[model samples]
Target: MLFLLILFLGGPAVLTSGRVWPLYGTPRKTVTLSSYGGHVFQEEGVWNYSTMLLREDMDVLILGARETIFALDLNNITNKKAMVKWEVIPDTQEICSLKGKTKETECQNYIRILHKMSDGRMYVCGTNAFNPTCDYMSYTHGNLSLESKHLEGKGKCPFDPFQRSTSEFVDGELYSATTLNFLGSEPVMMRSLNDSIRTEFSRSWLSEPSFIGMKHVAEGQKNPEGDDDKIYLFFSEAGLEYDSYKKMDVSRVARVCKGDLGGQRTLQKKWTSFLKARLDCPVSQTKLPFLIQDVFLYCPGDWSTCVFYGVFTPQTDMLQYSAVCTYRIQDIRDVFSKSKFKAMDSSSSRWVTYNGDVPEPRPGACINNNARQKKFFKSLDLPDKTLQFVKDKLLMDQAVEPSSKEPLLVKKGAAFTSIVVASTTALDGSIHQVMFIGTASGSVLKAVNYDEETVITEEVQLFAHSVPVKILRLSTTMGQLYAGSDVAAVQMPLSSCDHYTSCMDCVLARDPFCGWDLISNSCVAINSIQPDTHSEVVQSLRDGKASRCPAVESSTTIKFFYPGNMVSLLCEPGSNLAQVQWHVNGHPVENSNVYQIQHNTLLILKASDSDTGHYNCTSVETIKGVDYMTQSATYELRLGDFMTDPSVQPLVQEHQNTLLALKVLVIILTLMLLALVAWNFYKGYFAIPKCFNSDEESQQKTSGCQKPLQTGGRNSAASKACSSNSNNNHNRLSGNQHNGDQVF
Candidate 1:
């Protein structure tokens, strides 16, 4: 019984709890960049792993390779004529090669940033063979061509292609957080408009920051006294003020005002609106902090309800796991407004909180009407003391915490690389958010949140090769997901409704984009149905109740077998969370040496006449507090004699025929042997000598073949007697021969 319990619990049963439920099939459509002329260089080491941008209105995808940029048609990606490519000049290649860098790998222009300006033109930046440069790409007459005007790209793009950087373009201005030096030692957050305004954090403010993402959020306030738009940047940096023995890296969320100009006479041509705070995403069970990898913004309807989903991993690489945490916009705002200020105390040589009075216009506040009322219309008009205070108080003491202490999804064995989110409206008019997380293995995990529990519905392999996914873009208008990798980019549909073949599969998927259609008996996309006619759609994803599914009746199958034969019966319960039970003749079957149960299979070893009976299998499932039972078709097993069974009649006949054929072969060989013996006798093969008589051998035995002398000596003794006996013997032989001739 213990062995049976172990097998039942640890067998090949699907786990529908915290683990991922594998999808039956992949997406229907997949478009790779190689199908078009995206990478025509065709070199061994060159890669197209740059970021990707989707223009849904234009129905095109824009991506950058090493020195080229490609625009692909989204509808028909394979149509090469609809594609366009632009290759930047390689004039600075020789200069970059002389910089002691790897010419083959590093000393090449790598296109990294592509942002569309407020005008029709696009702003592009590249490493430019280690000499960073930026250019404008004009789109006119259905063609994209590079302009002659070149701008310095030190603060706009990173000097290394492998460096982590982020940029966003808003209102003809570019805001970016990137490394500006060749060695990637100097990290800066800069804004470039008519004039570039750059700021580098002091060691006390930021230490070795690695930027991940940047987003421009607009505050939807029409009041003239309200603040303007703001740009938030997310990064992870080494902590310098932590009172610990070892150094630690902390995740940070920073914000900057959109309208702040450079301060005059104090911090010229530099940002005066930079303020950052720590971001906390802690595991409740382990109490270990996680480092942020990537962040995605989920804004369905209003900006106030927007949430940021961040992918985090342990600071140390010893733990091979990842987690996802969500933060509301309101929580982030509260942290920035109410957090204390941290400043270095030179007297004690340690960091301490500043309890001094704050400046009038609160450091890092957006330029509002209040600033204008105080005769400070721009950052240049602010006092020198105000600018110094803002710079010194850049680091906030309070950390921004996630909404839940527990993570939304904690995945083991894979590190998340990118993330995107979408929302769907259920029949109850509630909005549910679904997250699609990309991993380092070029696969995507689809998960949904049911109250507080996050369940993984499916995992899809987006690339044939296991290259890391560099970028992931979601298009709500086209209902597609675009993933970029080192070799190619693939476009797949957001929801694969047709993959679900049955009502149970459709409901169990818990996909917001899919629902069961009773008319077609298939899973269909919610968007495909008309707005007013979807009342009959069955959408019980949360409960997973299969009551609406039609029950199938299976017929009894009778099987015959001889005694001592092994029998196996298969039982399919259909659901992953079900327990299978086997019964023989309406009595429960117990596990023993002769009877074994493996998953949904019942094995009967060395079956006998007593084992002949009706076998049935039942499946029991417990969801919430209710139990549902389903039964399989009955199996009739009968035992019979091996020789009398009708099924063994042909085999018995075959054995008899084989035995008769063997007997006939033996008889034919014996007859042939007899014939050979008779032939040898007729050919005189067994002839014997007539003088070799037994009595002569005893009386006149000679020494060898030459017996003349011995015979003479024996003859002298009985010459007279022998002569008389020989005459009688001759007469007797003549009489016998005459008698034999008369008989013949």
Candidate 2:
């Protein structure tokens, strides 16, 4: 049965272990840059923020753009930045133009790589008019200087600006996954400078891949066997593993050992420790598969326990849906080290799990202490049979499952493009992971990821329009996030504490960066508070409860208006998560035509004699299975008919036995007036007037019937003439009767 299903899917099923993602989400607050006071950096002609590097030690954010590189101050990005400019020469532009590429867009230097070298220098690269090149750069005294010579960057940098690639400088060597040709046909994962190990030139190895990012991982002191460090690449590639109805791309994570130096003869110049596995992040109960767009690696302390936070979107463009899934290092390691190998059946041409005898010592096992004990210290020492076996069985049968068996966050209406995670210690002494996700719409969603449930605290909008988030960086120590788009780069604090002015708002925001300070009686940044007053600060990140806030007397806003006037009582709420309710004379405000609540505003349809009372507005918010209610606002609706001396006690805040007000009264009065008019019209209270028209007697005006418009002098004369004709006709009929003359 498993083989049949695998053949039907066109490839072996990688979704053996998976779970569902919830469709519901919390109400998140939206903030704009103009209102939130975020610092922005946009040089006169600088655009296309392709790459960003945050150096907390130097207190600056380095940005890479088209033909330019900028080093903006972390304190305030609006300040002038240290810059280095690189442009494509005329000869290079001409050569690029002759290749059938757009001279204006493709024939230019687009800075793509900004890697830090081991010696504290910078390694930067650009697509120099379809020709990639690299240079060493130095930053000193808030300025940038470049090395005299440049290196060929065909493998180090992508030939095109839009192609996705990942590279890092590890231990004075470069490990990269990118396309090497001018047309970007070849995709290779290689290690250079110290080793010449690369992937085999076969479709089974890559199959048209789009690389996301790469991370170097060593088992650290926690490893018992001291395994060789590995570089893992995250990407999405076409489902060449299947022969389905439509071309579907699957997310993948591939590993390559640092010590691999290719094989002696069987797979010469190719890595012997190359293996790939699928990353299963199926969204919703329908089991819709999502393609990975970006990944952020979070390591608490040891490299062995690193976490990969991946942002995904569905291949179907029906909805702009996105999700963030988390994968642990141990889960990925187990799949490659212990999971079964996926292989193609020779007779059926269907991909299936291999049940044959496994190669001894493992085909792609790194040279750990176990292998070293057996005298296999490197890839060159491995037998030809192991190398040939690994080359054909590059894919593992089992996939790497997510940590929680579900996505950390799932959202609709926004296509998430990049992400950065931060671990924060809230006032409750509990650690929480805050994920800052950048969207294609140029907004950042700050989502608090619980173990199984997720809540979005807020959304900060950076650009006024849609601009893809090309670069996103986070500085944990500074509590700031840097986001770059096609237009500019923006630096924003992790939280807007000032936006939550009240104690209830601060606590209910569920923001780990903000807390309600009892000493100052205001919402403040947690880091800005004094250490001595740490206990005085209140924060509840788990459920965002305001139960710790002391009760206060809500000020009554007295509003006096004339009778028959409409009064709108507004309830300004602090948090979007709470529901607003209004009360009149101490009872729940019944929603009638006369009394309406719209967009948190209470409207008294028309202030009348009986509309004199007080209106109280309250907010009820649920946090961690507990409901917390607070009086947000109060209003005294005093009609002119009830205004009296101030010494007298006012009316109650809410009214009981509430009935429909002005609208009902008006409807009854209108009906009575219409009935009386109809009865009198049929009874002829005044003397009835009859008038006739030659066109139609039924169309003439008369007081006994439904009257038409009363015309003046001309109609009166016509009525008199018609009366005379009737009288003469009656007289002639009497004379004819007297004369016994029968007229038919």
Candidate 3:
């Protein structure tokens, strides 16, 4: 059966009548670059990977541990750093006078949050004096304000600015989350704008058991009528049922008005409420718990409509994995209007619960003002009376029709440890929502929904795979990503000029920032191209220049010369073969070889005027089939007198013909003489030449011509003997002797 099939298939192939044979195909070229290996980094610091701010104005600012902030250029110029506009704030322990602050030496008291206010001032907040103090500084010129109320005396800061604080500026108000002290944190959300400031604690507003962290993602984001700005906060804690059980159900996204902040306090309505809802999380097991570690606001162009993205994970010690949950801001506002969980005259609202096997406590339980509760209450400066009227107007059972449409629920089951969302305008003028995440295993993952069908994920393992990512933040410009933990800070350029393929390859190649120094074995940038710096071969691409390549020429002939020799090659204007290589016969010359390849490949080599030959160049190309080998114009090298050797000349004409005829005449005469002598010798007689005077006995042989042995003798031995005897006599007498004797 196999033989029959083979014959059937071979019929047309054997005939060679059809065109399609073996199916046309080209090799798939997939680029592969390594992501593993190690090399020394030029910058010194640990866990400083998260970026707090990214601006495209050629200036990128990043906040790291130990108060290390780096202002770098769009192009990575970290090395050969002439001057780093930087300053390292001392650790909280060394600078803060708090008793145990010095004992806890590992505490990173550097700046945790950075935001530019409406006044063009950059506000930096530290965890405490031990954590550093909250201070406002002019971003353009380094003008720092009095270190708030936190940095005073032997050191008693009202708040720990570095302690997981989230700050946002809205309508001239700076809202932030801060722990009151280092000992037992009195976590609270504070608002400051001009002269007025106020604080709302866990006891009065959120009414939660405790607090975790807060993230304010809405920057200058507001409601349509522009009456009030909505700032979203995500908070997490242990559930009421499972006291020690760290559950994500305890995590809640809430909205508050910016105008209500830093105003006259009221019993029940100290802060104007907007909305709150439990994140729809996916988790298992009551013992293994979850919490909202961080929150990020993402507004992909449609400012009025935005997605609230949060990082939900287990309590630090109990966390099994990480997850990312997304909810719409409109849904959260629904929670505040409900009668089931409303603050009526200072009385806490009823707590609701769910029976799902998900994160323990159901949504609706309030957040007790931790880091997660600090919102950019830059809410549109609305009248308190209007907010009160809206709250009063909202009926308990009546559903509030959200101004914005429901958020498209995407990526419900996956987890992440940290998330930061930013809006960016693509090169095409379209806006996109980007979420940056740091995984438990120290993997930095970026998630973006380019379409309704797909979510893109690109991740890089930042740590040694063991150190879980503690924090991650992407600069607003989205140009840098920073990841930090207990160890090191890693900063990478988010947008670089190099191709993405080349970037991956460069990473895989493990080329260190150390500039390549020919004197030493190191990988360096070719830009540092000083003679002594390094020997690098830079590839200059000339799109469709010239072809001086011998490889493109006919295989039959090739000529080679040192560089600087003048030789030329011709090529069509639109040839696919863009490059030309000059070969001597068959061998290719090394790049450094004296032969120079030019733009036109007029193969301009500096010739000593002596170099000339049938120089061959080939224009090589890989096309659909049959690789093309194009030959250049054939050149006949004509050298000047000094270049040509006179000793090497073509042969003379007369001597050539004379030699041919003289040789023919000699052969004919010899043969004739032999015939005569043989005839006589065969008849038992001897013969002598006319010129030879021989005895009568010897000479008498000439008369006896007895049939000459029939010329062509029947006996082979007789014939040979006759031929030999005749041949010897011819040699004895010559034409010269006959001619001379005749004359005498």
Candidate 4:
């Protein structure tokens, strides 16, 4: 009786099943990250390797591990590189521990610098038991050698093991931004080697800054009038303008001219052209400000068109949301060159703009041909008043804006840590910028800036567990992405063509790196072609329409299910973003109780004569308000009349006996309920009905509160009726045929 009641009312188990379905934003490919090239540190000892340098020329990745150095093979196909250790003395380690330092974790040497010099050598440095030191090193063909002598590394390297520091070499000078003290309180930007110059200690100069990245820009090449090159630094620090009770963090971009020589008298050995401005990336709906975490510079030979992409995250919100904002090189120039200065010593307490008359030749401007023509070419020749005014006035009044005045991409529940972009050319001779963003959840999202919006195409897992991605580098020539974490460094292909097998799947992916080849009838990379302009390849990135695929009929398969068994027809659509459509007898599915679409499978509750027909499945994609479809699978379902055969008598009789038992059980329960009601009435538990229809009571009908049972019997009045469904299914099913004879 319980089973029959559930079936008559449509059981919830059939309506809701424990199945996970593929939806939009699902990645087409998933592969675990692998680590290799470890002979010294082993697998379990590989820690503090979040920073690395890719030497593509040598086909190796230079790493700075804890008290050790290694060079892993490029592409990671075969691990072969140098593996060496650089440790401190036992007496030094004991002294470090006595001064309230950790012996196992913090007191050991941690190599933090692996900078490439103008000459073919590496300038390496390490925190030797809290006393930093530096030396010159050489690596070639799995061999390593360090200089016999080490030098003092005060401003070139940070005293702390994990302090945020960035350094690069330009014109044979090492320009570094790091701390100067053991406690990491003194932040400085200095250029060492060949007349070293450093920034003076002032609250207005740096203000508790945490530097992220620094890049050298070639500003002289784009100017018709001669000018010097520049070095731009991106960081986040406490806001100096906003008045709030809590700490407010804001992003900043500081710039210094490469040819900036120190001032003469008032500000000797100090940069005169050091200026910084605010970076704004605000989400309008949430009104949350995102702070910059990392920046990548893309300059394809010209400085004017160079663009900088930065990864940003919220200040204090617990959410894992992130945003990507872009700034053109030209827009940054306008803010620094045209905007007024924020006076460091204003009369009022608040930060005020300077409205006084500016000095001639622009005190904080790089020396150009115009300045030379006016007899003001060198920093040493500048006036004392001009140098003194620029000493404290380094902040600009205007803030730099993004290319579209908004974030290019805003993703929720994923904190982006690093980003790298590559310019790709499609088959239609159009260029698109593909960005590979690394998240804190150890995954990489592949997105493209199309028209004015961003579309995320694919997501690939680069690590087995949830770990933060500290470094991400793109190799356009090799077509791969190399990601780095504290314990692993893995390589992933930029284009995964093997996931898509059919033509429709290849086009629907909308990936610029992959396309469908009509000649071979398989998906392949765009670069695999000879000239890269093939007529057989098909790619619809703008619309993602799959109707362009040529018509090819799939082989028809005959399927027969027993009288009372569940049937499922699976449809194979390669992409998760596609919409699957199912039709029966060349018409749409009509009945809900019989047919259901779940997890790309068409399910039938109980197969019978009424469920027999020809079924077809196709994949549809929508783009720009138009639908494109291509056939993928087809099936013919037939229910054989097994009741007419003598061998099937036992099964049919068993099904009938179960139904009879349910009816008998329902009658017994009804009698017990009547006896209880009579006793309740005698004890005056409730009042009886006072009025009723006389004619209705005389005709003996079933009570309105009683539920009617549903049975699938051929002798029932509804089943024997000659309706439209019977006319359509009469021609396909035979009277006395069984499936066992036709198909095993």
Candidate 2, 1-744: lDDT as tens digits: 334334544233333235444433444577787667789888887778879877776787778999998888888988756888889999999999999889988899999988887777888889998899999988898798878467888888999988999897888888999998997889999887667668887888998899998988876346788788889899998866665656668899999888788888888988899999988885653233578888999998788769999999876676566888999998999999999998878898767889888786799988888888888887888888888889898899888888987677778777889999998777656777889898888888888865466888888888755687777888988878888888988988877788776787678777888899988899988767777888899987766667789874577887776777788888865556767888888889878978988898988888787888888888777777786664467877775544352323244212221344656788999999999988998898746545454435455443223322465687767666766766787798799897885544
Model 1 CA deviation exceeding 4 Å by range: 1-46, 79-91, 94-98, 138-144, 148-150, 223-225, 552-744
Query: CA lDDT, every prediction?
Result: 0.72, 0.80, 0.42, 0.75
Question: Mind giving the per-residue lDDT tens digits that candidate 3 earns over 535-612?
Answer: 332211111111221232233323334444454554331132224655543455444434665563544456545455
Superposed Cα deviation of residue 471, candidate 4 (Å): 0.7
Write the residue-wise lDDT of candidate 4 on 415-488 in tens digits.
88899998888888788888888888878888886676566777776764477777887888677777777666
Residue-wise C-alpha lDDT for candidate 1, range 432-507, written one tens digit per residue: 8888888887777778878766767667676654677778888888777777777767666777778776675566
lDDT of 4: 0.75
* TM-score of model 3 (CA atoms): 0.47
Deviating ranges (above 4 Å) for candidate 3:
1-51, 77-98, 104-108, 128-132, 138-163, 193-226, 240-249, 261-265, 272-276, 283-289, 315-319, 342-415, 421-435, 448-457, 475-480, 493-744
| TM-score per candidate | 0.74, 0.81, 0.47, 0.76
Which stretches of model 2 miss by more than 4 angstroms?
1-24, 34-37, 220-222, 527-532, 560-566, 640-744
**What shift in Å separates residue 214 of candidate 4 from its native position after superposition?**
0.4
lDDT of model 3, residue 141? 38
Error in Å for residue 600 of model 3? 50
Record all residue pairs in model 4 with backbone atoms less than 3 Å apart, i.e. clashing.
Answer: none
Error of 1 at 301 (Å): 3.3
- Most TM-score-accurate candidate: 2
**Of the candidates shown, which would achieve the greatest lDDT relative to the real structure?**
2
**TM-score of model number 4:** 0.76
**Would you list the clashing residue pairs of candidate 2?**
10-242, 584-654, 584-655, 585-653, 585-654, 585-655, 586-653, 586-654
